[model samples]
Target: LAKTTQPISMDSYEGQEVNITCSHNNIATNDYITWYQQFPSQGPRFIIQGYKTKVTNEVASLFIPADRKSSTLSLPRVSLSDTAVYYCLVVKQAGTALIFGKGTTLSVSS
Candidate 1:
C-alpha cells in the first residue's frame, strides 16, 4: 500500500470542471485506478480502477498518466446533484487488503 496525499475538500460551481489529484509514491504496475465513492451511510463503492492511462465513464474521467505515482480524477460539469464523498484507494500488488486516501468532500453549487 502506498501513502496517498490529496485535498480534503473542494468547491466547484455548476457546470465547472473539477480535478482532484492524489499522489502516491511507489504505485505498482497492477495497482490500477484507485477511485471510489461513498454515499450517505453506505460503504465505499468502487468507481474506477485503471492502469497508466486515461479512463472515462459516464460519471467521471480518471487519468493515471505514465508517471505511475499520481492520478487525477476529473469530474466534468459537476452540479449540486454530484455532491458526494469520494476517495482514492491503492490496492497492493499482492491483491490483499490495502490503504486509502483521506477522503475528499466535493461540494457543488449553482
Candidate 2:
C-alpha cells in the first residue's frame, strides 16, 4: 500500500465547501484512489473513488491529476453533521485487505 499524506486537521463553518488533499507519491499503476468518511466509533463509509481525472457522486467529488500522484476530495456545502475523519486509500488491486492510516479530522462549526 502507498502511504498517504494529509493535514492532521481542518476547520470549516456550516454551508462551507471543504477540500481535503492526499498525496501518494509511490502509487502503483493499477492503484485506484478511494475516499472514506468515518464518524466516531463507527466504520468508515465509502465516499468516492477514481483512477484518473474526476469522479462525482451525490456526496462528494474526487479529482485526480494526470500524474496520479495525488487526489483531492471535495465536499460541497458541508454541515455540522458532516464533521468526520476522512481517509484517502490506495487500492492496488481487488481483494486486498483494507488498511487505514490516521485520516484528516474535519470539524464543521455551526
Candidate 3:
C-alpha cells in the first residue's frame, strides 16, 4: 500500500497563494487520496479527494498526476486566518479513522 508523506511546516504571507504537495508512491488501487485541514484544537476538515486528474472545491484545489505518486493542494489568496495543519491520507472509504503522521503546518502571516 502507498503511504502518504507531507512536509512538516510551511510559511506564507497573507494574500498570497500557497501550494502543499504530498508524495504517495505506493498508493493502492482501492485507495483514495484525501486532504484535510485542521486548526489548532479542532478536528480536520476535508479539503479534497482525487483518484486521478484534478478536483477542486470552495477552499482548495487538488492536482494528481498520471503516475499517482504525488498530489498537490493549492490554497488561493490565503489569509492569516488560514494558518493550519494540513494532512494527506490514503484510505479505502470515507468516515474512516485516518492513520495520521505529523502533518504539514502552514503559517500565514499578515
Tell me the deviation in Å of residue 82 in model 2: 0.5
Best by TM-score: 2
RMSD of 1: 1.6
Model 2 spans with C-alpha error above 4 angstroms: none
Each candidate: what lDDT?
A: 0.82, 0.93, 0.89
TM-score of each model, in listed order = 0.88, 0.96, 0.93
lDDT of 3 by residue, 1-110 (tens): 45789999999999998999999998877778898889999999888988899998899999999988899999999999999999998878554567777889999988
| Candidate 2 lDDT | 0.93
Query: Candidate 3 — which residues are off by over 4 angstroms?
Result: none
Candidate 2, poorest ten consecutive residues by summed lDDT: 92-101
**On residues 26-91, what C-alpha lDDT tens digit does candidate 1 reach at each position?**
776667657888777788887777777899888889998788788999999888877888898778
Cα lDDT over the full model 3: 0.89
Query: Higher lDDT: candidate 2 or 3?
Result: 2
* Model 1 poorest ten-residue lDDT run: 92-101
Estimate the Cα RMSD of every predicted model relative to the unseen true structure: 1.6, 0.8, 1.4
Q: Candidate 1: where are CA atoms >4 Å away?
A: none
